[model samples]
Target: MSNWLLPESLADILPAEARRIEELRRGLLDLYRTYGFELVAPPLVEYIESLLSGTGADLNLRTCKLIDQVSGRTLGVRADMTPQVSRIDAHLLNREGVTRLCYCGTVLHARPAGLLSDRELLQIGAEIFGHSGVEADIEVIELALASVKRAGVQHARVDLNHPGVLRSIIDSDPALADFADRIHELLGTKDVPGLTELGTQISGVQTGSIQALIQLASLYGTTGVITKARSVLPALPALHAALDDLDVLIAALPGHEFSIDLADMGSGYGYHSGVVFSIYAHGWHDALVRGGRYDGVGRAFGRSRPATGFSLDLRKLSSGLPAAPVAKAIRAPWGTDAALVDALCKLRAAGEIVVQMLPGQLQWLDEFTVDRELVPDGGTWKVRAIA
Candidate 1:
């Protein structure tokens, strides 16, 4: 194997893609700032307990662990930044009122999420802590939609679900407690037959509960599924509450297309509590954004604040879009003359891309197009269009 070869499911992001990703990150952080969201950054690695705080077992499997030489404790490379942000909101800031925070950083996933996914991800997102109202959910959802739109994604589709819906159903029957994981796995794929088989095989499992699970699996489509869910599922308040959350979100978010899948447990990380959502668009095989309310996340950090947010891999987002155009640049001959040096500095200060050619060096720029040239116009350097 060549030394230059990266591990499977990982690759270097070249100049064009890196530029696009960086621009998107800056634009998104600025957009979040406009919404009054302050930026926060957590460490890339921390104690395993701190990194995985409040997040479920799924993130545990995704995290890459190493023994810290300084403390001799297990440190985990973050697979997701949400929990760390929650810790900051819960422990460090300790603000009583609503606090909005945004962040951008790289995350290392132990395994690729899919065949097309890379193990390393540039995750960027925003979170609102201490607000449990559907209003906060609304704010997060709106911002997420705005993010993709700003990235030039066309015809973005939104999907809404509440994990509490399925969670409530599973909790209603004690007999189904031990089989929760398997149940979620089946429902994730909408494997109705597998669910039925589990129902028949498991001793003391209620027939009605299994039947309801099957019905929920099929309860996917337009927003109408929310209404359909109320009639078909059990009359548990928690279940209805989850359905109500979805109904409110549909009413709150207008002008964007939405689909509902009552069965999707959402990243299967188990922290999602209310009104979960995902954004999908053409050219991306998976969701471009995933976010929801996980009010309990802060509890593991000593405070239980109502938190809602969303994140997406900037690399993935950039890869799905059309190629970014080569940046137009002004090329200048390298020289130590004060006037020439001054001209280069002034152009760069004005946000112009200036490329200085070395002596006898070939003009080569894969990421930039030299459309203009700096020349000695009589005495002072001036920029002119290249013929």
Candidate 2:
């Protein structure tokens, strides 16, 4: 007999942790509902073609692939929920103006190189389809901030950026377009020397703007930093416009701490047309939540809709946050007093944490300082405190 078990990167959530996750999930869903995003659960698996739409190669490689014998077609475990939700809006809902949807599910991503630490992660997210303007983007960011607060992630930082700023620069300089991959690598690694060397290669490149953007990447803290960024690259209108949009979002979220990172920080999603951002907590090294705008993804599915969203890596957040409180046990006296048994059963059924006491357990209860005691009476159970 072979002893096989779950993979290393995967995990099984048990009792208290699972309960905490469910409670957090419900809280987030309730928060999403307040913002008018109805809940929707997409399948865990889908046809490869459908799942592949709009997602980049990095994400595609992570998908767990399999061949469906019945249909004789390739299928994939969804690497992320965004593509599936997009499919729903395009094919099922078919709404044109605007559709706000929320989802909580598990996504499987196989990273052979193990670049990402986890293969199976629980994701909770919300998507707003059929909205293109900056207002929609702001709304998404605001909602994300609210959700994180509701989840009890203290001292979170919302780092905002836009792909358009980098895309515009690359488009203007054809030579730089070829070095896009290298530039992204440098940005990711914060290799300033390498970025400077690469910057020197492009003839007539705007070093001022590039340097400003690089400097902005390290900027953290309040709205006042935007003024400093504006001073550095005042001539670049796209950067200026992105800053303005950020100001609007900042004003909307006065309670949240925000900063701007312009070094082209992102997940390498090609469909992201504008305004990408990530959320980080005080303790976690990586972003707890990440998302942005993708206006062209729906068009690929024959539905020209603009959408924006953010998803939380629930497992990661759970690990970083404080531990959940455990329910205290309620001890009942021994002897199967029918009435007492029925009362304890009712308490258990009512979801109150309870524990049955053994014959000599009363002494143990005194030693342990148990929370409550149930005494069997003729037709009733008397509840008392043992403190």
Best by TM-score: 1
Report how far off residue 380 is in candidate 1 (Å). Answer: 1.9
What is the clash count of model 1? 0
Candidate 1: Cα lDDT at 241: 86
TM-scores of the candidates are 0.97, 0.85
- Candidate 1 regions with alpha-carbon error over 4 angstroms: none
In lDDT terms, how accurate is model 2? 0.77
What is the C-alpha lDDT profile of model 1 across 84-117, one tens digit per residue? 9999999999999999999999999999988888
Model 1, CA-based lDDT: 0.91
Candidate 2 segments whose C-alpha is farther than 4 A from its true place = 1-5, 112-116, 199-225, 234-236, 332-351, 355-370
Error of 1 at 94 (Å): 0.9
For each candidate, C-alpha RMSD in Å?
Answer: 1.2, 4.0
Pick out the ten consecutive residues of candidate 2 with the lowest summed lDDT.
Answer: 361-370
